[model samples]
Target: SLFRILGELWPIFGGNVSKPKLTDMFYIPQKPYLTVGTLRDQVIYPQTREEYDELHDSDAGLAELFALVRCSNIVEREGGWDAVNDWIEVLSGGEKQQIAMARLIYHKPKYAIMDECTSAISIDLEGFMYVHCKKIGINLITVSHRPSLWMYHEYLLKFDGRGGWEFGPMVLPEGYQQGTA
Candidate 1:
């Protein structure tokens, strides 16, 4: 599936075939974790500790990023922004994905590779997230079987499990327009 495509594509993009450039791109698997660091640490990645310190000191910027992902309430709900020790344990799957998306929005990477990462999220919210990401110029390379996601993307990079793949513009339904859903 998509993982295989990513496995081979990672090296050309930056790292070993199995891993991509962690510093700039967002890579979310079906299962995500907060063990990488605190919520603050997760979103401010690629930024130096000094840069994180600057944004943390400013506060509003970080809060706004969370708000953009529809997760500002969770910071307080889970005890506070910087205090969530294990976000995966405290938050649900959808919440974890939202956090990942928040990081993407904050970083505004040119591209992201997601593998069924938003499986737990409602379609409406997922669509909103995609729209917002597109608005910020983030090109998504999503790996999902959900046709519901097709409207948000412009191309299809299909991998046929048997060591073959195809790439082309996405074909939408008759009378359906991109980004209309």
Candidate 2:
């Protein structure tokens, strides 16, 4: 069914989405799936080349976001954001996840559902993402088995994998130590 739907909707995503002729490629009235293929594409996703050009003839703050993710060496190594390549081929797992987090922060959605999105990120940087999202007033319904992640949420909901579940206020796991500033 999914393939059939995507096929029917292919006109919207057919060929190069950058072509202005495809603008009339059937209206869906809502956000559709978007790909995060490149560093720049991740930041300004769903926007075609012309759309992004409308926002900037120059570069954006990708360097700063990279630094925040503790993965700032990309821009210098690749020459700049303009140095496009198959990021999936070049980047490590953690680097890819870091880029994903940067995109979430850039989008600043009101709510987010992170399903093991931080699996490859380091614990420290993972916590940084949580804190940053909280600071930006974004709520996260994170899906992780990392006990340390519980501290960031207001509630905990656990499923029994049956027709049952438990939901309540946050419960810090045992031996959890708050890092001193």
RMSD each, Å: 4.1, 9.3
C-alpha-based local distance difference test score of model 2 = 0.65
lDDT by residue for model 1 (1-181), tens = 4454553433354434544554446666777646645667666655666877755666687788787777788878766656747666777787888887887787887778878978988777888888888888887888898777998888888778887989999998797544434
Local distance difference test, each candidate = 0.73, 0.65
TM-scores of all candidate predictions against the true structure = 0.79, 0.73
- Inter-residue clash pairs, candidate 1: none
Q: Which candidate achieves the best lDDT against the true structure?
A: 1
Looking at candidate 2, what is the lDDT of residue 70? 76
- Residues 46-128, model 2: lDDT tens digits: 56657878766666466677788777887787666766777767777777777777767766666666666788876777888
Q: Report the CA-based lDDT of candidate 1 relative to the real structure.
A: 0.73
